[model samples]
Target: MVTIIKGKDRAEYPEFFTQLFKLRYKVFVEGRGWSLPTKHGLEIDQYDDDEAIYFLDVNEHGIIEGTVRITPTVQSSLTADYFSHLIENGQSPRSSRVYEATRYIVRPSQKSRDLNRAAKSRLLAALTQWCLENDVESIQTVIDSNTLPTFLELNPKVLPMGLSYPYGGGRNTHGGGDCMAIRWPISQEILECVRLYGDLSLLHAVDAISSENIGEMIH
Candidate 1:
């Protein structure tokens, strides 16, 4: 079954963060060829250590299936660090209702008839629950284009919130990946999608939510 984890509580979380890193390394770095820093193959960034919240899925065997990263919109420098152009061009919204979703990754082993869908749906449910309890109005994520239609198809309520833009590159980064910001309601559809597809990788969902429904979605 899937589980929701928060903060650094070890007894409840145990080695979850470690498992999370291992899965991240295998997928984001080795499996997907993302140019994340290497040393142990795990992909970690400054964002991982910040005021971010994580939603994790673990299988019956205690293996991590997938993970999603959420951060306060105000804490993220999306307007200043990456999507400045989108903001300056009046393509992105600046609102307190929004939160940023990032660094999503999932293990391939979770792919299955039931598990995939369940994991994804659960993740969305957890996020929506957090939003409702915290009085959050919207969720913003820098996601892929291919997954756009899936997000719309899966949950029509998460309206597109920003312009699309290319992601990762240059001397210290990977290439060709693109992402966009989409907003989710505090409840309702967001919870339903999570209830259905929580087992599916948030990375895949994010990518699926981006690609206009063409290729296989991966984060």
Candidate 2:
């Protein structure tokens, strides 16, 4: 199951966020060796403010398997602040309809290549659905160059903002190879392709999040 946590509703789900922070710490800090702010073993940054919306992929046992954070570019964007040079012609997209997705991670325990691929696909599908509903026209993100092919496979519409550059620990970096920024246009066709790649039924992907369902889960 997927849970959509709006910045305003974060107080209502303390445990979820706790686990999410730990998971992030495990993946990015400890695993990837990325230097980031840490408090009580939780990895967090300024971008985790109330303006961010989170998509968490949880299992039947309520364990978070994967997660992604999306923040509006008009507000505060990692790309605009840190990676603006990566943008094509150095034009970072800043608009209400444009969002930057960061901290996308899946638990490393799912070591099987196929399992990891499926888990990432599901998370992407859920994100695409939410973006479609929220009228998000484009999503900007920095990703490892090695994974660019996978993104293209899921949605051929991905546009590279700039060339990949060596980052964080060189070739053996946790994210893999060089990193680059890319933008994905949100549309029905893109969503459909994601759904098909993940083999997710329309109901499973589109109806994953709703007020009623969230209320039930929270209680």
Candidate 3:
């Protein structure tokens, strides 16, 4: 069972952020042996704020199992922040109906399902639902070389968008685990397929933004 939460304003979903970080810490740091200085035992960065919509997967016990962040890749968020040297033209913030996906983490407590095809399908479904409601047409993801196959397995439509190289010692790649940039088209039908495999929610913008309250709405 997976629980999905969409982040709202800064004040409304504070607990969600906390849980998100806790989940990150468990997956990226403690579970995966990622040696990063995670303050409060959670992995968080400056990019997380009111504008970012968080997709959280929690278990039946309400414990966060996996999580990811999706934010508008407009001019405000230049790809330079994460991968500047790789792109020669330099990343410009664009509101061209694009959404950047990053910070994908799965807790150690839930590793049993990471390789499960059905679970992955459902996760994709929830993501598509959100994109449809928000009118997001383009979606982007950074993949580690080895993990590229995993995303590719999700569908043949997945495509590499920009430069590919080792990221964070290539921990994300399936081989060296070097990260690669990838993108794919998001459609209502495809997202619907994602929901079929797992649980999903279409969060309200106001509630998604509120840091004090974390919630989910089924689309």
Which one wins on lDDT? Answer: 2
lDDT of each: 0.65, 0.85, 0.62
- For all predicted structures, in order, the TM-scores are 0.72, 0.85, 0.71
Residue range 91-131, candidate 3, lDDT tens digits: 44355688887777654353454345445665566677778
Collision count of model 3: 31
lDDT of 2 at 12: 96
TM-score-based ranking, best first? 2, 1, 3
Q: After superposition, how far is residue 129 of candidate 1 from its true place, in Å?
A: 1.6
- Runs of candidate 1 with Cα error greater than 4 angstroms are 8-14, 77-80, 87-95, 106-110, 168-175, 193-219
- Model 3 deviation from the true structure expressed as Cα RMSD, one decimal place: 12.4
Better of 2 and 3 by lDDT: 2
lDDT of 2 by residue, 9-50 (tens): 988999999999999998888887788999999998999999
